[model samples]
Target: MKFKNRRNECVTTSDGREIWASRSVTVVVCIVLVCEDQPYILVNQRGTGVPDCQGLWNLPCGYLDYDETTTEAAMREVWEECGVNSLELLQGADCEFFSAPWDISSTPHDARQNVTIHHGLHAHVDRLPAVSNAHNEPNETADIRWLPLAQADTLEFAFNHRARIAKYLSHLERVAWIRY
Candidate 1:
């Protein structure tokens, strides 16, 4: 099925199952930082009061508000969660879509089906922020830190962030020849 302006579309699986497009799409932005030739990612730990994935580390991310572009939402989330106001989108880092309820069940009895659009971003900063909570939502984020890419796999991450980070790192490696 297709909607006007193509806002939504339906897909049919080989098994003869049809899937409807999600009504909500969230944008997950991975902010990359390089220091002394080593790469790092800005991540936040979900607070205990958070509704989901409490205590798990994840990239600075948030849902796209009504009428807000992905770029705007990414920048806003980074600033609010990490206090980093200067960021640039990585070249060739296009958005990726991931479906929720991996089972691909047509009947979602709980949370509405969601599609997460991931974006990669880069920023140069002299130092990391000492304190977070800039957005004043403690339950959403407990703490923020810069984690070395090599050590990212050591931490428990929320959602599919670990895979997303790996994808971003692969992108960086592929485009290493390009300057800025």
Candidate 2:
């Protein structure tokens, strides 16, 4: 989170078009890990170099590559973003999820997408920590924190990350909001 926060940070690529609307190209699969020993949630300080939501705080996440299932994408993203190796470490199927149209409105006319990658959130308890979060470059991650749940919202994150995380937590809690 060392990078500058560009309020209204709009991610747009122009092959020379001048329209002004925002769009999400790839589906982002994210996860939250609850540690058993410490009543803390694991979150990574996203390296500012990562494309798009650079310098922002988010769950360990990555884009789904071709032909990957929702579960596959989530697992792959967890591995890529956090350096985790096995999905077996986690054991659960609960999350809070909300999605809007992945937009390319800001892009050129050719930015139409036939395939829509839905944004997914997956969470589980980590029996043990893994190497997925470790990077040789400090820029990738300056530090990892097992932030307290009570104060989790105080920290800053990009996109609708906080909402996504809170929503997932709400789902896991079996709250009444899900019916709406």
Supply candidate 1's per-residue lDDT for 165.
80
| C-alpha root-mean-square deviation, each candidate | 9.8, 10.2
Of the candidates shown, which would achieve the greatest TM-score relative to the real structure?
Answer: 1
Highest lDDT against the true fold, candidate: 1
Error of 2 at 54 (Å): 3.4
For model 2, how does the per-residue alpha-carbon lDDT over 89-111 read when each residue is reduced to its tens digit? 44452443323212211222343
- For 1-180, candidate 1 gives per-residue lDDT tens digits of 864433467899999998876566666776666667666778888887678888899887777797887667766777777776533333322322222111121223345445566666554445544546767466778888888777898999987689878776666556553122
The runs of at least 3 residues in candidate 2 whose Cα sits more than 4 Å from the true structure, single-residue gaps closed, are 1-38, 91-128, 134-142, 175-180
Q: Candidate 2 has which clashing residue pairs, if any?
A: 23-103, 24-103, 82-132, 82-133, 83-132, 84-132, 96-168
Give Cα-based local distance difference scores for all models: 0.65, 0.50
Clash count, candidate 1: 0
Candidate 1 residue 44 Cα shift, in angstroms, is 0.5
TM-score of each: 0.68, 0.55
